[model samples]
Target: MSSILTNTSAMVALQTLKGINASLSSTQNEISTGKSVATAKDNSAVWAISKVMEADVNGFKAISNSLSLGESTVSVGRQASETVTDLLTDIKGKIVAAQESNVDRDKIQTDINALRDQITSVVGAAQFNGLNLIEGTDDVNVLSSLDRKNDGSVSASHITVSRQDLTSGAGTFGSTGLTAAAYGTVNGATASDFTSDAAGKVAEITFGVASLAANDTYEVSIDGTTLSYTAAGTETAADLASHFVGQINALGLEGISATDEGAGVINLVNTKGYETVAVTLNSTSDANLEITDLNGGGAPTDGDVGTIEQRASTIDFSTTAGVNEGDSFKVTAGGSSFNYIAGRGETMEDVAKGLKTAIDSNQPDGITTRVQQDATTGQWKLAVDDANGDGTSTTFSLAVSAGGTASGGLFGLDNIDVTTNEGAAAALDNIETMIQTSIDAAAQFGSVQGRIETQSTFISNLTDALKTGIGSMVDADMEEASAKLQALQVQQQLGVQSLSIANQAPQSILSLFR
Candidate 1:
């Protein structure tokens, strides 16, 4: 027990001093770096979670930038559309003035034409970086996404913002028949004067045309009312006069006349005057239809004149019958079959285009598409019309396929989708809707962007708080560590001194033994 190797006091004191030195160094590191877990060795769990959150924050920043770009593009388009609307309103005012007979009719007409031309110019020039929303050019997609709920329900933010061009300048009203008809004149005066009764009834005029010039003007009269119009160069007898009457009849105006060859009696329909009247006609060899009884009397009643009313545009869309997302619905029209997967991004446009191309291409079925925007429901519904080549225009509703979600919808806007089964017809309607939808969606995004920005700032601060929390749990207290280190150093020195004295005593015991 008295041997030098058995001096445990000194060994313990040296070990204690080494422990104090390690504590001092640790405290100094924490003080200098201000972080207890700067490395994985400090606290792996907190560091990992914080790193993941940081990555998310970075991703959010990138998304914010993308949203910003999309917002600006949509904003530009909305501004252009609004500006063009103002111009259209101004044109409407000019048209109203042109309706007034007391106004300088010719001057008003000229002004209207000029205003129309100006509107055209405005629509043509309303473009942002070469994208014209008013002139009916390109479409814009606002980048948006939808979120799915745990119950399998899906909701979404409009990721794609599309701008619709409504500038009537595209001149795409195609193939709607609107040509004039051939006229039959019996002859008697300048091509412009027509025979009429005292009540302004159109008199009978029949002419045998031996190849009239393309722009020749013909005037036929009954009593004295002259019915004058231009003739096409190709006008011939094979062409039925009734074919011409059909259109004019639809205009609520008297447009034709006839005579009984056997009775030498003339029957007429009047349009320019208040009451229908009749007059006698005397055929002259002047190559033009001539008439006498000039202004004596006899006008046709309203019953004698036919009326014409324009039917609504025939449009249709294609969709499956009562199918959900898991089910497949196939619509074959215009020679092609468009299939829809329930709950997927099956747009009315996609369905409409198939029918339009099919019908126009004459694929046995005269299929067309019409889409409607129900401003009341805010649902973009797809309706397919007339299953096959049948002349019936029927409508059926379609929704997102099962497992499919809706996105890019306008906030507070109802029925934004084209609801017609006819493609071109749907386009005409949607061209207006797509615009309003985008505007509403953009405004919604603006509100959301503001909210997200606020949340981002809050999240940033929360992250700092979390870091502070983890630091509180494990970080070294520098002031306390420093004080403890000093105390421990003093204790180690005293222990060393005590151990040395004890060793000396043991040596003295050995001297006594000697």
Candidate 2:
């Protein structure tokens, strides 16, 4: 029944060899390319996803570059600010030395001027790639990330750094820019506190009675309010005092308190206002009782009793009696200095009044001035009171120097011509402020630089993560591909031999015919 034309065995072998050859070729392609899905046709959905992630990785690399640039720029500004702070500290030392009466202040002032010029140079050169963060009031942005949302939307993340201005040129003075602290370490205007014991004298109302008798009555009057108390027969002087105390306590007068001292004496305290307090007393039953003004009808002579310390800051003009037409004196107080130059026909009184006027010219808030004259000693004093005090725990000092020069520059911190006492005093305070500003700028820049560095590192790590994800989707398993290549090669060889054997079966049919 087998015919030479229809050799089914050979046909089946040929088809099997063709299938094995095709699989072998595909395995070789995978080994060479190292990718299971090298083209969109291989895995359309996975390939598209990997492509999108690859684009993200590239974008993140660019952001890393931007962050590097931003970090470098901030570093430069931070270093410059630190250098300026150090220079300011050096100038402060020179100013402190000038405070000594024996030192040559003019020479120290020259050193101060040189240091100021160097600061100007440092500020001018503090830049990276022509971007100066400490010279202007603009903001710089650094690309930090590419945010991809779940809804298939994309946005960019940026780190914005603001600028700190360190310029000391035009518009930097006269209250327009770079103003110093107006009120430092001074008393503030406050609620007036009245104290009877503040004058260091005790006010006493006395009674001549050896003991209290029945139906004995005494009256106490304070700040225009009077309360009377009657004693029982068994009551002594102490009991009379206690009964009076109970009555005043019941009244609960505002800003005033009453206490009973022993031996028929009463002590009254005024805790309310700055007004002069008047205390009077009369007794209806004690014909022998006596009351007197302990302080001669005024505040207690010793200011150590329950008194609030008033404007106690005093600038004595006692040492200023050697009057000359051209002599000058300088006093530094309240973060500024007041210089007084003696003119013709000006006395120590005029000098004291002149300094008071100069201090008031600053127009500090809640500040009041008084020029007190000691008529007996002919001594004049300038007192400054801060109504609104600086704070509860604030304190300050004043620097007064005499024999000063008439023509020396003041502290713009550049014009610190310490040839005179006034210039040296002003520079001492101004330099402290300048140094603080520089330190603050350095601290701010350091924070920004740290942020940029952190963001840059995060972007680099995120880019690596994305690359690994893309690899997982598209990379070939080389170990599995190598095994498949050997297996497919063996299958192909066997298929070729089988095909040869099947073709020979067709020739056997021919031999049968022979």
C-alpha lDDT of all candidate models, in order: 0.40, 0.63
lDDT per residue (tens digit) for residues 40-132 in model 1? 676788667556545544544555555565555555555555554554455445445544446564564455456546645655675556655
The prediction achieving the highest lDDT against the true structure is 2
Residue 148 Cα positional deviation in candidate 2, in Å, after optimal superposition:
1.6
Q: lDDT tens string, model 2, 105-180? A: 7677678779889987888899899898777555788888899999979999899886766665321111112111
Give TM per candidate. Answer: 0.40, 0.55
What candidate 2 gets wrong by more than 4 Å, as runs, is 1-11, 172-419
- Measured by TM-score, the strongest candidate is 2
Q: Residue 346 in model 1: shift from native, Å?
A: 13
Q: Which window of 10 residues has the lowest lDDT sum in candidate 2?
A: 171-180
